[model samples]
Target: MIEHTALVVGGTSGIGLATARLLQQRGATVHVVGRTERKLDPELIPHWADGGDPAQIAAVVAKAGPIDWLVVSLSGGEGAGPIAGLDVATLRRAFDAKFWAHLTTVRAALPHLTPTGSITLIGAISARAAMPGTAGLAAINGAVEALVKPLAAELAPIRVNGVSPGLVDTPWWSGFPAEARAAYFAQMAERLPTRRVATAEDVAEVVALAATNPNLTATVIEADGGARLAALV
Candidate 1:
């Protein structure tokens, strides 16, 4: 059991919250930080700050005190369309949310990280999968994955890893119409070799593994239900 403190930025919902719960189960004291309005758990301590803002993230790092683990799980922009039609505003917002947030949070939290601490960034399968309408997301995910190596090297013993998930059933898809969302999930389930979409718990398990494993650093763990293999078939 991990008997240390962990901070999960963007932990109010979705994968972030799931990872927090998992870490808590493993015996870590979890402090959750949400950028905007969020329903916080009573059992876990709460901190509020925008992940994209360095000042805000630094404040959260200070408020949380020392941390043995830090997970950055900010979601991407919602307005992604085709590359030609995608506006600069949308792309900028996506970058701020997905890319800047991870960097800013890590920069702020690095000082407070314990000697054996781990840092896990939530990435996406878009980094590898060549799907339509994910141009912006793919770029952001790629950046997150790219940082693993340099970050791990710079942080030394503090491991830096990523959990790249594909088509997880999370609130990220809840904005779509119920029927459409269900259909999309079904389509992905049929296409993936695993015959099912990922759950938040599925990604969370990998996040936990990355955080605890001594030998793992600068690695991007793919939790995509064999999407790559399915794409070939």
Candidate 2:
């Protein structure tokens, strides 16, 4: 039996939170790191850190102790908009949050990772399929996946992989207009082979698989309910 401790960055909501709970159920001690210390179960150890801040991430990593698994699930700032209308500051903010935050986590945790430890970076289906107005997300997600292959080799026995997910019903969409959200889900449901968008549990299962499976490394699991396939047709 494999027993290890895991540090899940951005584990307070959506896929990250689900993955943390799943890992705990699988016999791993899981510590969650997020910006806020609220909304987590009492059993969960919360490290308040704005993932965009490298120093905060370093402090959290130091306190989390030796980690056997590190999952980076940081999200970008916002979705796509017309290129000309897009604010430069907004674009930079998104990159800092998702791309730079990921870099910070890896940099801080690389030394603390135990032998045979694994790092799972989260990506999105937009990395592969083109989505209107989602250029910023696509760019960052693609870059993260691109970094995985070489990093896996460099990290050696410590595995590094990525999971790219499609539309998972999460609370993040609450900020969107109701009609827009409904239309988005409707499109996803119609195109995806499963006739529905993915769920946090669906993504959590993939994350658990990446953490526990020994043979898989430098791999990017596409958890998009065949959305990529539909896109080809």
Error of 2 at 175 (Å): 0.2
lDDT of 1 by residue, 1-233 (tens): 44799899989888889989988877889999886777776767888889888898898899886898899998764535689888878888888888888998999998899988899998888888887777878888899889998989988989999999987898888779999999888887989989998888988999889887888999999999988677622
lDDT of 1 at 198: 87
* lDDT measured at residue 83 in model 1 versus the true structure, 0 to 100: 91
Name the top TM-score candidate: 1
- Superposition error at 24 for model 1 (Å): 0.7
Mark the regions of model 1 whose C-alpha exceeds 4 Å error after superposition: none
- For residues 11-107, write the lDDT of model 2, one tens digit per residue: 9999999999999888888999988766886667788898778788888888886999899999855746666677878888888888888988899
TM-score of each: 0.95, 0.94
